[model samples]
Target: MKQIHHILILPDRVVVDDQPVTITTQGADIVTELYRRYMNDYPKFFKMDLLSRLGLVAADILLQTEGAERGAERDDRAVVIVNRHASLNNDRAYEATIQPDNYFPSPSLFVYTLPNVVAGEIAIRNHYLGETACYIAAQEDVEPLIASTFNEHTTSVIGGWLDVTDEKEFIAKLSIWTH
Candidate 1:
């Protein structure tokens, strides 16, 4: 049977295994706070889009709480992420850079225009080399899409709904599922 460990991150709080772990300050950015608290060693985190940052932080909490390996390649692990917006926040930023008056397209923002980049960021951070996929679907349809990524070679998975909007509203309900 597959055992799943869960973590949910919101702008106001963070929960792990159904218990509240952190109550974020009212105006502070939860992603930045989480990065400062858990990912100070990883400087690259500062450059990622909000979606990637949210996903990575959620995965970090889930994996750390579950005592999973970090900083080592793990071929048995996979990453799957689902969202409704599909990187629209970064896409808007990237679009702004290419506007007619200010035609300076940022390569950094451009890379994050795809939702799959969130999954890639999570995989790269944890050295998970198995399948990495992102799906754009309604919240109700997320389960089957995530389940489809599992296979015989995959022993564990980090996946769930990760969505962010231009106004910085976000939610990351991530899980670590182990066989």
Candidate 2:
């Protein structure tokens, strides 16, 4: 089942360096609706953590349609590719945390050190228990990452880039591919 595809794209949004992203009213409303639909298991969805909030939004976009929830079994798979340009130095802060001389890592920003955390958030929201990975690149290398996934023969991949800086630009695209 080797194939190439382009998933959904959530345009005009941006993710922050070390904080929860600010979304448009349309984006927020979409997330809220999806949470009400697929997240019935969770009684108090609004009070969920920021991590959960981000994940739900990703899941909502990835799993579009009403019955999409039915396909969101534990066997489904997903991957997240965040854009480096989303922020001025979001990755730089992650690096500084581990630097010996400059221990300037902010605790708030440290939580996002694991790129997969966002993936996990989406996984939890949609109950996708297959496989996931997170990568860091400046830009123009997204194809390499996509090709590597093909080499691994992973199907139904959901990949995109989320960048948050002064401009707040987000490019989250979910591509369901198979090999």
Candidate 3:
């Protein structure tokens, strides 16, 4: 993980070159809804409703757009970081799933339980075909998260947090690093 090409900060609703990309909520938010939006927008590319499927779906999209930034080439080594704490707001589901004895949860909510779903989404969307990992924290902690994932051949990293509570507030910073 030597090359961090560019770090993009998408705060709230932002238009990147006239394209609409917004972080509307935070904390226990319905991440699936966001997934649906992506599906709707890129119908030709993505068609998924489950978290696992969404992970791969997102990864495919990432490979094409963000992955192309470096040299119009694809690097499966690229990593992605999803800020789960800030983006998840479904406290009810969180509590139910985390119950001591409740191992089997509503399959829908269970998929989002792991923080790495974000990376999964990106990998699925882009078909990155790289090592994928996820981290969970109350706040943003980039050092350890990035360090652990960084490798000598790593070209760049798509890292950030997404939160969706009552309203919706999240930030995903896709940074491109180089050594």
Winning candidate number (TM-score): 1
Tens-digit lDDT track of model 1 for 91-174: 988999999999999999999999999889888888888899888889987677766767788867889888886544788888
Identify the leading candidate in terms of lDDT. 1
Candidate 2 lDDT (Cα, 0 to 1): 0.51
TM-score of each: 0.93, 0.54, 0.53
Model 3 scores a TM of 0.53
Sort the candidates on lDDT, descending order: 1, 2, 3
Model 3 per-residue lDDT tens digits across residues 1-179: 44333323232333322355565643323234454544445452233223333333334334344545533335546555555463244445656776778755667565565656656666555566767766666445765566566676665565544333333344444444344
The CA lDDT at 119 in model 2 is: 67
- Cα misplacement distance, residue 61 of candidate 1 (Å): 0.8
What number of clashing residue pairs does each candidate have, in the order they appear?
Answer: 0, 7, 52
| Shift in Å, residue 31, candidate 1 | 0.7
Return the TM-score for candidate 1, rounded to 2 decimals. 0.93
Q: What is the lDDT of residue 114 in candidate 3?
A: 64
Model 1 Cα shift for residue 123 (angstroms): 1.0
Q: Which parts of model 1 have CA positions greater than 4 angstroms off?
A: 1-3
Writing each residue's lDDT as its tens digit, candidate 2 over 1-179 gives 33243433233443222233455455445455445554556554555433334444555544553224454366545565656543233455667676888777676566555556666766666677767666667556665675565443445666655443321233454444555
Off-target runs (Cα >4 Å) in candidate 3 are 1-12, 15-75, 82-88, 94-105, 137-140
**Worst lDDT window (10 residues) for model 1?**
21-30
